[model samples]
Target chain A: MTGQVRTVDGRVAGRRGQETRQKLLDCLREMLSTSPYRDVKVIDVARMAGTSPATFYQYFPDVEGAVLEIAEEMAKDSDTLKELVAGKSWAGKSGPTTSEELVDGFLAFWRKNDAILRVVTLGAAEGDKRFFKIRMTVLNSVAKPLAEAVKELQAKGQADKSLDPNAVSGALVSLLASAAEHQKAFTSWGVKVKDLKPNLAPLVYLGVTGKKAPK
Target chain B: MTGQVRTVDGRVAGRRGQETRQKLLDCLREMLSTSPYRDVKVIDVARMAGTSPATFYQYFPDVEGAVLEIAEEMAKDSDTLKELVAGKSWAGKSGPTTSEELVDGFLAFWRKNDAILRVVTLGAAEGDKRFFKIRMTVLNSVAKPLAEAVKELQAKGQADKSLDPNAVSGALVSLLASAAEHQKAFTSWGVKVKDLKPNLAPLVYLGVTGKKAPK
Candidate 1:
């Protein structure tokens, strides 16, 4: 478990202090959703949280630091994604279903945290080590177990043996992440929102099983 | 054809004016690769270009506007990506070669323009319509022809009929784009940089043809 929350000045946050800190974080998260990342400011966050800038500073050194905190929390929550693949059947009818659930679950998680994720992704692509690590953590939550599943399928002679299991899983996860991030792009390409999962799940099935999804 | 280049105030730029504008843009592009997008300033870009902020403003309204100019240029260049898939054969050994070349060409394009694409991607993700449009133009350059290829395969009874051609091509293009943008993520997952194309090419082949790549 994470140890006691502390202020920027290094004081351990008491119960009331933790509540205020959480409130500030919640407000910052809300502001990020509505405004461009570059325009978000501490004073606005402080005003929204019914606190002073000094209080905001006590909990976070800056906006980026606070954003990192939210990203870290989201990365931790991504652990649940493992269930979408781990110990799940990728055989026959069960295979396509697993792919569907994985796509649905992954897309839902992305939609829920998209605003924060936009910043995290931008930071990582900009070569920020901290954001890069947080992103890898999130992607690896599913990629690791998915790779194992691909390896199992290959061992059983059910999947392509020539492909690198890690690469296949990594590409699939990257595909899911990209599709989730830019769902609008698909819309403009004439693929409706409802059609996204149906299309994506089959590709996942194809990638993992090296066969078309069963009719 | 696109019309002559004009300044922010609607003046058609003469030869000397165009040279200055191009220099400013080149300097800004260099600055973007070195600095965070949020931290990039007009004064610095102008300073780097050996000009004043007034000269910078003559060509572009602001930093973001200049970025849009660069992104637009890149989007135009992306038209070359269409050749990567247009009229390409997707049968037998030719199919895997096509996939390899497409992946190679796409990744190389992305790596060369990664800095601008990162900002364009971030801006689009944040719901900016202009950036969204530019990003679409770039992706469509490849996705359109790629979708046509998938449709052709499906028509020939080579790919799955249950799948949507547009969706499959969109997803595959999304996968390549994501993988290209986040190659570092794969490296951390234990997939070598050199291994990315070999691993990705087969997935593309499998997705489009609905069969394993031929050895």
Candidate 2:
């Protein structure tokens, strides 16, 4: 479990202080969704939170610092992704259903936190170690479990044994991430938002089961 | 073919004018690689190019405009990605080879112009129409041809006819773009840089042909 939330000055936040901190984070999240990360200012976040900039500074050092806090929280929530692949069947009709549900759940999770995830992605891509670590945490939540499933299938002669399970799982998860991030791009390619899951689910099913999904 | 280079004011750029414009773009590209996109300034780019800010303004309206110019140029270069998939064999052993070469060649193209592409990715993800259009042009350079190949295979009964060729091709191309952009993520997964192509190629082969690669 995460330790008690602490201010930048190393003080443990009380119940009221935690509320104030949470409010600041909420406002920062909103700012991220409405404006480019570069334009998100501490003063704006403070104003939106109805708190002084000094109060904002007390909880977080800067916008990037606060963004990290938000990303870390999101990473914690990513634990739910584990259930999507864990204890799932990849045989016959169940395989396609598992894939469809996985695609649905993953895309929903991404859509829910896309604004912060976008910043985290950008930061990680820029070689920022902290952001990269956070991204890996989120990715591994699903990737590690999915890799296990691939390994299990490969061992049982249900999937391609020559392929590396980790690589396949990694590619599948990366594909999901890309699809979720650029859903609009898919629209431009003539794929409807509603049609996305059906299309992507089969690819996931194919990648994991190493066969065409059952009708 | 592209028409003659012109300044922002619609005047035809002479040899000297084109040199200044090119220098500014080079400097801008360098700046993007070294610093955060949010921090890249027109003044900094101009100074680095050994020109005045006024000279920078003559070529581009602002930093975003200059970034778009660089992105547009890179998209043109992306035409080369088409050759990687177009007219390529995907039969038996040749299928895996085609996948391998596509993976190798696409990753190289991304690595070569990563700085500009990074900005374009950010811009597109943020819903900037110009950036999104340019990103599509680059992706379509490969995705279009790749889709055609998939359609051919499906028609020949080599691929899954039930699946949408465009969807499969889009997903595969998205996987390639995501892999190229986050090479380090693969490294952290205990997959070595050299191991990436080998792992990715097979998946591409599987996705495209819906069959295991030949030995």
Give lDDT per model, in order. Answer: 0.94, 0.90
**Predicted candidate 2 versus true structure: per-residue lDDT over B1-215, tens digit per residue:** 78998887899999999999999988988999999898888889989999899999899888988888888888989988899999999997788888999999999999999888888998899888999999999999989999899999998988988778888888898999999999999888888888889888988888899876777
TM-score of chain B of each: 0.97, 0.95
lDDT per residue as tens, model 2, A1-215: 66888988999999999999999999999999998887889999999999899999999888898999899989999999999999999887788889999999999999999999999999999999999999999999999999999999988988888778888889899999999999888888887888889889988988888777777
Chain A of candidate 1: what's the TM-score?
0.97
User: Ten-residue segment with the worst summed lDDT in candidate 2 chain B?
Assistant: B206-215
| Model 2, global lDDT | 0.90
Clashing pairs in model 2? none
| Candidate 2 - chain A - TM | 0.95
Q: List model 1 lDDT by residue over B179-200, tens digit each.
A: 9999999999899999999999
Fnat for the candidates in order:
0.95, 0.72
